[model samples]
Target chain A: MTETLTAPAPETHPRYAIEIDGVGKTYGSGDGAVTALDLVNLDVRKGEFISLLGPSGCGKTTLLRMIAGLEDPTQGSIWLPGRGLDGLGFVFQRDALVNWRTIIENVLLPLEFKGRRTKAAYQRARDLLATFGLAEFEDRNPWELSGGMRQRAAICRAMIDDPQLLLMDEPFGALDALTRDDLNFELQALWPDPEKTAVFVTHSINEAVYLSDRVVVISDKPGRIVDITEIPFERPRPLEIREEPEFGRIARHLRGVLDGHSARRA
Target chain B: MKKNPLAYIPMQVWTIVGIFAVWQACVMVLDIKPIILPPVPKVLGELFGNFGLYLRHGGHTLGNTLIAFAISVVAGVGMAIGIVYSKFLEKTLYTLLVTVNNVPKVALAPLFVIWLGTGNASKIAMGVLISIFAIVIDTVLGLRSLHPDLIDLGRAMRGSEFKVLMKLRLPNAMPSILAGMKVAISLALVGAIVGEFVAAQNGLGFVILSSQGAFRTDRVYASIIVLAAIGTALYYMMEYAEAKLIPWHESRRSHARPTAPSKPAKGPVAQPVASDAKA
Candidate 1:
C-alpha cells in the first residue's frame, strides 16, 4: 500500500492522476482498419469524479479499459500520481462477479487475489457486507440476489482492497431508472477519501450529469474529448438533485453535444 | 417420485398377467406344445425356484461392472487433464484413444481371457475398455469448454493456470463430466455382461448363457430382467448425485425451481476510491 502524499496548506491536486497522452487502439493492420480510440488524451485530477460521456462507438469502454490496464493503449501513457496503481479497483460493465462465490465471499475476492487470505480479512469482508446492507444475504450466491444487490456486492468486491483509483464502465447502465438513481445516491455516500481519484465511462447523459464532478464529452469513433464540462452541484447530492433546474440544464447541454456529434456523423 | 415406486410392481404384475394370458391362450386355443413356450405357471415356478443361484451370478456381474466403471472414471479424468495441460500429449494420445475406442473390446475378450485367465480380470478389463472412451471424450470436452472470459477474469486477477483449472474449469465442467460418467456406467455394464458371454464361470451373463444351454428360457428372462434393473439403478444413482451436487446448475435448477427469477443484475456502482498502489 502506498502512503498518501501531502502538500503544504494548498490543495496540491494530482496534476493528472491518469495522463492518457496520445493513446490509440487499432484492431487490425492493413486493409482491415478499425481505430477504436485514436490519440485519446485526458487528465483525471485527484479527488475528481470524472465521467467519460460519449456516443455508442466513442470508445468510452476502450478508454476505461486502457485506464484499468485491462487493455494497453496503442499510443499513449497512463499514470497514477503520488501512488503507483497497485490499488486501482476496477468494476467492469458486466457484474463479473464469480457466480459460484457467495455475496460476502465475492466481496472478499480482491483480498484473496492479493493473497491476504486471513481471518482478519474475512472479518473485514463481513463488516463490509453489513455496512453495505447486504448482511442478511451474505451467504447467498450472486444468482440468488436481485440485480441491484448483485451490483452492490460487486461494488463491495471492488472496494474491499481499498483502491485509490476506481474505474467503472457503465456500471449502472443495465439497471432500471429508479435503481440507478438509488445507486447514484449510494455511490455518493461511498465516495472515496479526499485523496482518491476516479474515472467512469457511461452512455447515459443523465447519469453523467447526475454523478460526475466533471463530464468529458467525446466525439464518435476514434474518440476524442469534444468538451469538458465542470459540474457546479454542491456536495452530498441527493436523488432530488436530479429534479434540480441546474442538473437538467447540464444534462440538456450534454444531450445537445451528443446529438450534435451524431448529426455531424450523419 | 411422481410416478409411485409401487407403480412398477403393479405395472409388472399387469405385464406378466397379460403375457401369461397370451401364452396360455396359445397353448389351449392353438393346442401348442408346452416345449416351445412353456406354460406360464411352470415358467414362473422355474424362475422363483432358482432365485438364489440367479442372485449369485447377478452379484458377480455387478461387481465386474463396478470395478470397470471405477477404473475407467479415474483413467478417463486423468487422461483428460493430461490432454488439457499438454498440446503435444493431446495430439499424440487422443488419436490412439479414439482408435482403441472404435475397436470392439468384446471381440478381443477371448484373447484377454487367454492372457489374464478366465477370471475377474478379463471381465473387468472388457468393462473398463468399453467405458473408458466415453469418460475420456466427455472429460476432454468438459475441460476444453470452459468459458474464455472466466479464464480471462482469473488471469486478470493473476491466478495461475493451475488455480484457474481447479477453481473455475473443473467446477464448470462438472455437468459434462457427469454426462460422461452416466454413459460410461451403462457401457461398463454392457462390457461386463459381454465379457461374461465370452468366458465366465459366474455372473448373470454366465447364468443367462447356462440357462439358455439347458433350455430354461424363463430363468434366462429372469436374469435379463435383473440385469436391466441393476443398469437402471446405476443410472438413477448417477442422476441423483448430479442433482445433489450442483443444484445451481441449469439442469439441476430446472428440477429445483419451475420458474426462475428474471433480470439477474451483474455488478456494483462506480465510486471514487483510493487506488492501492499494490492492488
Candidate 2:
C-alpha cells in the first residue's frame, strides 16, 4: 500500500521495467472491506507486452490500474523503477475522447496539459494520426468518426507523450467483433516496440495469445495469478499467425488454465 | 453552389404560416367579436401601422432582458464552478439557488419592484432571479458528467488543475450550459414582463395592460404579436449560437439547417478507408 502511491528511487534491476512484490488492493478496511486483489507478485521485463487475462471482476483492470497508480495497493509494494505516473500512459476500455475536441486536438490533449503543446508536438500528433490512417480526420469531431477510429484516436492520445510504460485496460472490448479484430491487428502491428513496455488487460484468450509476450492467467475473485505462459511466437507475428495450429494450442492452454481456476472455485 | 432560400423553407415556416391562415379562417368563419379575439388582418394592420410605438417599448424590454441574461450567464456559470469545486458551496450555495428558484417568480417580481423601484432595475433584477437557476443547475450537470477518465488522464500526465478545468471540463460542458441559456433566455422575457406588470412606464406588458382598459383589442393583439416575434427571435438566436459554438456536439448533428452547418460542410473529413485494417 505504501509502495503504490510513493515515488520510489530508481531501481537497480535494469532488466525489469516494473516489479510487483506482494501487491494487493482492498476497497475498505475490516467488516465492509471488499478485497479486489490478493497479495500478488510478478516482474515485468523491459520492452515486454504482457497481458493479464481473466474473467470480469477478476481484478485484472484493478491490477493494471494499481501499476498506473490510479488505485493505491493496500498491501505490499509495487516498484516502477523511476517511471512514475507521469512516465506512464493509460488507455481505458472506452475511447473517452473529449467529444468537443477534434481528433488531432484530442491526441494533443496530454501535451497541452503538460505544457508540451509546441509546434513539434502538434506535428507529432499529425504523424501519429497518419500512422493510424486518421491523418485526413485530424480536424473532425469524435462523434463524426466510427467506433474503431475513436478508439484509435484514444490510443494515439496515450502514445503522444511517448510514455515508457503503456497500460491498457481492455481497450478494444467495446467494439464489434470485426472492428475489434481489425484494431487488434492494427495495435499489434505498432506495439511490442523495444522502446515501450505495455501491460494489457483482457478476457479474450485469442487476443492475449496473439499480442502478448507472456499471458498471465488471473483467478476469478480476489484475483491472483494462476499461471504464466511465455508465448514463443516469433517477432513481427502477422495477423495470419492466429490461424496457425501452434497459436490455437497456446490459446487453448491458457483457456484451460482459466477454466481450471473457475471450476476449482465453483 | 448557392441555393435559393425561397426554394425550400423548413417545415416550421410553413407551420407558422398555416397557423396564421387558420386564425384568419376561424375569425371569418365564426364572425367572432373583435373584443374576444381580434381579426388577424386588423391586428397585423395595427402592428405595421403603429410599429414605431411598439418598437420603442419593445427595444426597452429587449435591452433589459439582454442585460439581465448576460449578467445571469456570467454570474451563474461562476457560481456553478464554485459549487462543483468546493464541498462547502455545493452544500450551501447550490441548495440555496434551488430553493430560491422554486419560489413563485411572479410573486417575487413585486418584491423586486419594492426593493429596486419601478424602473428597469426591478425588471432586470426579476429577469436575473428567474433565469439564473437553470444556468447554474444545467452547468453543474454538464461539468460533473465529464468522463472520469478525462480527469484521470489529466492527473496521469501531471496536467495543471486549471488547464484541465479550462480545456477539458469547460469545453465538454458548453452544450449543456448553452441549453440552460436557451431556457433562461425565454424565461428572462417572462420575468421582465412580470416586473412590468406590477409597475413599469413602458414595455409590451405595459401596452397590453393599458389597452385592456380601453377595450382596444387591436392594440392588445399587436403588442402580443410583437412579444411573440421577440421571443421567437431570442430563442432562434440562442439556437444559432449553440450551433456555431459547439458544431461538434450531437445536438448539432441533425440535418444541416441554415443555422447549423453539417459535418461534410466542415473542410476535408474524408476518412481513409484503404488503410482501415493496416497502418
- Which candidate gets the maximum DockQ versus the true structure? 2
Give the worst 10-residue stretch by lDDT in candidate 2 chain A: A1-10
| Per-prediction CA RMSD (Å) | 7.1, 6.0
Q: What's the DockQ of model 1? A: 0.24
**For residues B128-242, could you state the per-residue lDDT of candidate 1 as single tens digits?**
9889988888888877776544554565455567777776777767777788899999999999998899988999999888889998777776787688779988999998978
> Candidate 1: where is the Cα deviation over 4 Å?
A1-17, A79-86, B1-48, B255-279
Clashing pairs in 2: none
Model 2, range A114-167, lDDT digits (tens) per residue? 887999999999999999888888987776777677788889999999988989
The TM-score of candidate 2 is: 0.88
How well is each residue in A222-246 modelled by candidate 1, as lDDT tens digits?
6777889999887777878889898
> What is each candidate's DockQ, to 2 decimals?
0.24, 0.28
